[model samples]
Target: MPILTPEERIGQVLAGRYRLESVLGQGGMGFVMGGKHELTGRSVAVKLLLPSYGAEAEIIGRFFQEAKAAASLNHPNVVDVLDMQIDDGEAFLVLELLDGQPLTDLLEERGKLPPEELFPILMPVMDALAAAHEHGIVHRDLKPDNIFISKDLRGRVTPKVLDFGIAKLTEGDSSVETRTGGLLGTPHYMSPEQAQGHKNVGPSTDIWSMGVLIYECLTGDRAFQADSVPALLLQICTFDPIPLADRAPELHPAITQVVHKALARELPDRYASMEDFGGALFAACREAGVVLPATLEELFPQHRPTIAPGELSAPPPPASEPEPEPVPAPLAKKPASKIVPMLSAVAVLLLVGIGAGLYLATRPTPTPPPVAIAANTPEPTPEAAPETPPEPPPETPPEPAPPQDVTHRVISEPAGAEVVLDREVIGEAPLAVTRPGDVASLEITLRLRGHVEQTISVTEESPEEVVVTLPRRRSGHRVDPVGAPALAPR
Candidate 1:
């Protein structure tokens, strides 16, 4: 059978309450369409898998598994899954229609983002992952393309994580089987373990992928790149990524450290949970003085604890009440006038005797004698000899001078045009730069290893400053071209 045209695709979606209006987009697995629910008349996005994959038992299982995982999660940052079905050998998913662009599209236009701007976008993505992870779901394919930046009615940006078709459920055994040399995710964002064909991946795998996504978003290049998939895999396994500061110097050291830790080749070294990762990322952003839009809950949903039966019920009421008041008494008083006159006469006689005694105690006494002075004429001649030569004061040693202030800035660069700087890496994007007080001559060196170093000079104006727009190295590697593959008929 020939590939179904747009009209044929729309006809396939019209069987149920959904009425297809136009083509939204297409990818390796399927095409997304703009549609409306007939009963509710609400706009929705319908994703129809290609006929070839829809008929396969394994692909069908994976599709349903994705639907189940997504259905179990209900988060503001996650795209809502309305329904799923298989009709006439074509499987499709109905999702809440979004009015925004994928992060991938934005990245294509702006190679990398400043730390101040990158965290706001990343926080929500982490939040969506945290929600899915809580529900025992791992979004195995967590690339920029799977993240969308949509706006609410108030025009505030809302990140919606999409495409869970390749996500794995952690509660039970994997429902779908894998083929050798047949990985289930985008090559650029897949973790080292995933690239090595390991099947027992869990939340850590998603964490690794998220690390790569953030690395790419801040540096304008994937964490690992090669001429082919095998080379990329080798790099992911053995190579230490170029420091983020070398790419985006404006990012704080804490921010770069977080990104590096997330991309750690070993899963144990990475963050334990998406929530942990999100918190670190957010904290780094704040330390760098970058303001983010959403709260931690908005980025990572809070776990709702389950209450057992009869745990929070109210208690019983009171029993009774009772009575009255009472009264009280008085009396007794007597004379003071008779005692006053006798006491006054005694007090006057005592005052007269005390005044005479005080006058005799304070009188001054007479002075007495002075001794004779001894005069020696010989003592004056000795002083005149000492005045001839006064010994010079001992020379004072000079104090050691303070150490010269050395301003250090490390800059890292990838492909395209962005630079990252860090004093000492702590966690995520937006590194801090420390400079000397006096206008010191600052050297900005761009290193993309295997490429020539581009050195430029800047004045030390601010202690912690970031410069984002920088020139790219002419000799660095370019992105590989994506190609279309042929799909078999249903």
Candidate 2:
């Protein structure tokens, strides 16, 4: 039954209600068919799960999960879930048909979206995610492919969030949960917690994915990248994203702050909720002077104004003629003798003012007079008083010097490991690591592929040269420690 092509399923009736009329779309899971309600003839989209997946209880359960999750959130920015059914072991969902394209297609067509075009579309997505989060649902797999930019009959843009298939319910709802430490979501967009396969993934996980998507939308590139999936996941778990300032320096600082906050490696440091994330982003957009639609209705009004081609190129209407200016009457000339005396008086006053200004400007700043010691103040005891040597004998002895900075020659058994001194990466081992003289001790962290990370402290009393032998990781792909400096994106 799974062998049939999408065309073969056309003209077939599902549960004697939705009749598959045409193939709307297809994916690895199954086909999305344009259908009509048999009784009402209402146009609808039917998402048919591939017959092979019907026997896979997990997949079937998730199929129904998407329906329940999406159906529960009746938001303008979220796609509407109509009905779901399983007929002859073929599970499917009914969704409202959309007119436009997925955000993936738009990004492909136009490499980078400018702030003016991006905020309207992006803000709504944030709002939709915020609504989903309110219901304790986290869309773990949010990416461009899951964001559909739909157009109403009037042709106004209204983005709808799609594909809640892998969504997780955080409130212990009836939705199926991903096994503990099971990895899900695309490699590039996974949060640190997701890459570590943490079971307690929450709203902050979605915030991380949104940050990646936003970074890509602003600068046609992924924030984190590597050659392989495991390598990418490791990068996501450990490394910081390529800085937005480097990717697109022209972007406003407010926007970059929001992005970095969303992409924070530590969950506690990240936005607390989708509302906070969206509010910060929206505020940043406004600060950057990027105008956004107040609401979906305002964005996609019931009736949109249209202009003809001729009107676009037509000349504007002419203005009324201006009145002519009146000519000024000639003034009587003043007597030469009277004018000379007045000029001389004016010159004398100007000279006096100039001399006064120069005198004030050239005056030197006065030194403040020393204050006399108070008569009632207590006198210093003989032991407390410093011996002046009766005169300023010789230059004052040099003040006791501060603790000298210590430089340690650090080397790992496996050379070329990343060496971090006091949380700041100082070249790779074998390297001369330095610590501030003021600090009592310095923390040194060494990391190398396939080995467990090793951290040691260095102090003035410790040996100048230090050596560490790292043990091999029990698992080849161990989750690396996060909060390192961001690796520049390639």
Candidate 3:
């Protein structure tokens, strides 16, 4: 008999039931087919393994293994496995026909998605994971390709989890056990522990992958990228993903915090479970005033209120009225106060005198070379003493020398934060400036976006290079209004 391709194998009736229509899609382990039940004539998606792979007991076992894993989960977000069979050299599994495309395709079409758009889809996926986790099952391979997003009859974009081929049962179900240290997940989506091929990868591993997925969904960028699989694995192990908030500042801190917790490398540092992660995500959405969609149709609801062209040309809708201001009751007036022109005059004069003294004290100092000259010059003998006798030695006072200039280089962790000297904007950071040595103090400040203003005291003993790593602003820190220094006159 001639060998038939997977597509050629299509249309062939299998076990007197499913009649394959055409190849729907292909994957690393198996390909899906659009088919109809012969007796019922109902539409369904059939997943089957390649014949060559099916000939092996292990691959055929895994094909059935996936069917078993998915059959255990009873959740709407998870793909429902219907049937499985092995006929001759062919092994196939049947699944519900999804109405929409994979998340991978959607992401490829749209660079990055807004928070409002991704929240609903993510909510259901997280729910599915939570349900699976409760049963001690971990979806070891979770990537955009395995996440099927479909539109139901109601037009709700429902996201369903697909492909449990490599899923590991943590409760010791005694099914097929993954060989220890066997690499079994997509490189880009693998967690640090998973990438390391650790023997006992747990739910936290799935949580890490979910974090990377959410990050990409919100930011339109991969959390980690490399040229090859080994390089990608190294990235997963060692690199700190660029923070989601840094890429999308509009995201609420609560949402970003949830991601940070989920992606934490250490087990204790990360969210304890999917439940905690979900709760935090929901709390963040609530705090941000984002209402989650409860209905299937709400997955891709109207992002902004729809307005007609005519309405756009018309005056804008009135804004919400502000709270009424309180009116204070009238109070009795006090008697007239006496003015003090004499004290004001004294204060003005004192200020002027102090300013003048400061100016004189900072005057350019002259170098006294005569003292050095005297030290270098040799005294004349007794012959020259007669001529020198005419000029009586007179007491000469030495003058103070002028201040020299010193240079200091300033730098910051994220370069380009504004540099301030004594509250005056000198220049942006990564700067070199010369200051007079006579100055009493140099108060240096660095201001960067999303970070609290950093201040430092510079002295002569300070190092030549001044570097400051600005810290993120603390919550509840007061924002000071613009003003000058308060002065108390004596």
Where in model 1 is the C-alpha error above 4 Å?
1-3, 11-13, 169-183, 297-490
Per-candidate RMSD, Å: 24.3, 29.9, 27.9
lDDT at 416 for candidate 1?
31
lDDT of 3 by residue, 1-490 (tens): 6777668977888767779898888754457889888877767888776554667786666556655766666566788666776656677776788899888888889987777778777767876777677767788778888788889777767788987634452212322223344334467887887766677777898889899999998898899988877798787788799987789998888788888888888888988777667767776776787776533221212322343211222332235867679976554443334346777889999999999999999999889676534556777765544444466688787887777777878877556889887678889989986767776346777898745577776656555777666543312222121121211211
List lDDT for all candidates, in order: 0.65, 0.73, 0.70
lDDT for each residue of candidate 1 in 1-490, tens digit (9 for 90 to 100): 6787666767444546678988998765677899887767788888877675766877776777777567566566778677776655666777888998999999998988876677777776776677677777788878888899998667878788888645552112431233333434577777778777676777888888888888888889877889987788788888988899897787789999988998888878999898899878777766777765423323432321132111222222223433335533332234546566777878887898788778777776657578676876355544444445778999999997755564443333222322323422232223334445453444444444333444444444323333322221212222221121211111
Each candidate structure's TM-score, on Cα atoms with residue i matched to residue i, is: 0.58, 0.57, 0.57
Model 2's lDDT to the true fold?
A: 0.73
RMSD of 3: 27.9
TM-score-better candidate, 1 vs 3 = 1
- Order candidates by lDDT, high to low: 2, 3, 1
Off by over 4 Å in 3: 165-184, 294-490
TM-score of 1: 0.58
